[model samples]
Target: MTEFGYFLSSEEHGPQALIEQARMAEQAGFTSLWISDHFHPWTAEQGQSPFVWSVIGALSEAVSLPVQTAVTCPTRRIHPVVTAQAAATSSVMLDGRFRLGVGSGEALNESVLGDEWPEAAVRLEMLEEAVQIMRRLFRGEQVSHRGRHFTVQNARLYTLPGEPVPIDVSAFGPQAAEIAGRIGDGFITMAPVPEAIERFRRSGGGTKPVAAGLKVCWALDRDEAVQTAHRLWASEQLPGELSQILPTPRHIEQANELVTPERVAEHITCGSDADAHAAALREYVDAGFDTVYVNQIGPDQQGFFDFYRTKVLPQLNGA
Candidate 1:
């Protein structure tokens, strides 16, 4: 079954607001949740970036649905030992219903600590090493690793989950997908590219769950929704490696100038047409994703939820 999930936008909502949204998602029939882990929002217009671990703790208390970090970068901004501890604590709090979704990461968030960002190949290598260290820590073993990219001295987590947290790797390219398959418990991507999924399966992913997240704007007026999506997420449309290499929101905003409203409208599912939204989600389902998470853009959160609850989800789920 292709489960429907809601993507909590940590970049757009405060911690309390995110908790409330999680509750609403559960009530509205979403099967799971995906929250982003970011040190910084992509652009200033999006506004909020709470500590994801704190938000996850509150979510454990607020919703029974499973949760996963849409993706967290364990390589640079935080050590894998600390990330492991945080993830283990989160999994215990959620009653072993949490997943640690990881990636090589982007400079917009990872570069904040003034560390020079490594290139893609190095970043992926560091990520592989970090995952090994984290898996050891999750087993309540004291880990002392002195690797090429990191060092951990006799670090152990006392508070642990009943089971080791599953780490899902996010990849958009073949190289990252290969790494994800070779090392990840599962695979994640933004688009519904069957070839990438096939590559992952061949590389080593096998039958592990595959998940993807997509954004939609559910405004009553199509043009209004398009403008909101364009203003808030234009940076997402930047070409090539710009998203991974950009150092700050300001630089990202400057780069966002290249994305036009027409492009956003063409690419994003906007407006109140239920069929359109259903069709958009169907594309991912058709691509063989086990789970698809949808994020509603702009301030019409309640409206989007209501629309999905009444019109879209029923159609998708065949309820």
Candidate 2:
């Protein structure tokens, strides 16, 4: 069966709010959780970026649902050794319910520590090495590695869960999906494009679960929801390599100015219609994703959860 999960947006909420939202998600009949990991918000208007590890720690105590980082970048900004340690601790805290979702990363978050953001090809290469290193450490063994992009010496983790944390790789395009299939325990993506999923399977993804996410705005007023989505998430509408290359929220905001509200409405589900929300999520389910996550674009957390619990999820479940 396909599982529906709530996506906790770290860029738009603080640690406490995120934890509270996780609890709300659990109470709302969702089966799992996906939380974004970022050092910065895509745009300033979104106004928040909490350290995801800290939030995960709190979440382990606050909720019972399984949780995964929708995607974390272990290649830069943080080292794989540290990431493995954090994920191990999280898995133990969550009673073996944690999965480490990772990717090649974006310049928007990875460029903050004076590290030059490498091109996409180089980033993917680094991601492969990083995952290799992380898996080695997850085995509770000491690791020493000297690689093209990173070097580690005598690194070992003491705190570990009973099982090695599963790493799901995030990909956007066919080439990246192929890489993800080669390296990941599962797949993480946003769009419901069957071609990408098929390419991944052909490239070795096989029956490993494919996970996806989408954002929607829920409000009594559709127009108001559209304005809110455009105001806070217009950066999402920026096309091409723009999202991967932009280094700062200001640069993102400048680019997002070109994304009009009409365009935002064109892509995002807005307003109180239960069928619209159910239909949006069903696209991912129909496309063969084993797990689908959804994020509420604005502050109507109660309404979004309530709507899904009472109206949307029932429809999706054919009740």
Candidate 3:
């Protein structure tokens, strides 16, 4: 059965507001939670980047739903060993209901450290190395890796869960998906394309968990929802990693110039009609995702939840 989840937008909501929303999402019967792990918002308009790990800790005390980083880059901004330790600690804190979802990463967030942003192939190579490092560290073994991109000297994690933390690699392109199949316990994506899913399986992944997410604006008014969603998350409509490695918000805004509301709406469901929202999400399930996460864009978040809870989730859940 495909399960429904929600994304906690660290970019739009404050910690208290998001915690309350998470509690409400639990009450409304969401099965899982995925939060953004962005260091910077694509634009100042979206505003807010609370450290996701701290929010996860609070969520551990506030709710029972399992959580995952919609995707975190363990390659550059944070070392894989550190990420492994964090995931281990989070797993224990969440009582073994946490999964680590990682990817090649973007420069917008990583380059902030003053590291030269590498191209796609190099980024993927770094991701491969990072995954090896993370797995070794998760095993609670001493690691002294000297890779081309990263090096760690005799580092051993002191605290880890008794079991290895499950890794879900986030992949969009075919190469990345193949790598995920070769290495990851599961796969995380956004496009939810059947071909990609097939590639993942063909490469070595089986019927393990497959997760994808899409942005939405839900309201009684269609135009308002589209406008709000576009205004807030237009950057997502832009192709590639503006949030992870891009130079500036202006670069994002420039790339997003191609992301018209029409273009975004074609891929994502925006506007007020409950059935439309449900159908939009259904497309992802049809594409082979075992789990679908929905992120509400703009400020009408409570309304987004209410609409999905009362109108959308039931239909998707087979009510």
Best by lDDT: 1
With candidate 3 superimposed using the best TM-score fit, by how many Å does residue 176's alpha carbon deviate from the native?
0.7
Candidate 3 per-residue lDDT, tens place, 195-302, comes to: 999999988998877899888877778777777777778777665555555676667767777789877667667777887888888889889888888888877777
Off by over 4 Å in 2: none
State candidate 2's TM-score: 0.98
Whole-model Cα lDDT of every candidate shown, in order: 0.94, 0.92, 0.84
lDDT of 1 by residue, 1-319 (tens): 7999999999998999899888888888899999999989999999999999999999999999999998999988998988998999999999999999999999999988999999999999999999999999988898888999899998999999888999999999999999999999999999989999999999999999999999999999999999999999997789999999999999999999999999999899999999999999999999999999999998888898899999999998842
- State every prediction's TM-score relative to the real structure: 0.99, 0.98, 0.95
Off by over 4 Å in 3: 240-245
In candidate 3, where is summed lDDT lowest over 10 consecutive residues? 237-246
Better of 1 and 2 by lDDT: 1
Candidate 3 accuracy as TM-score: 0.95
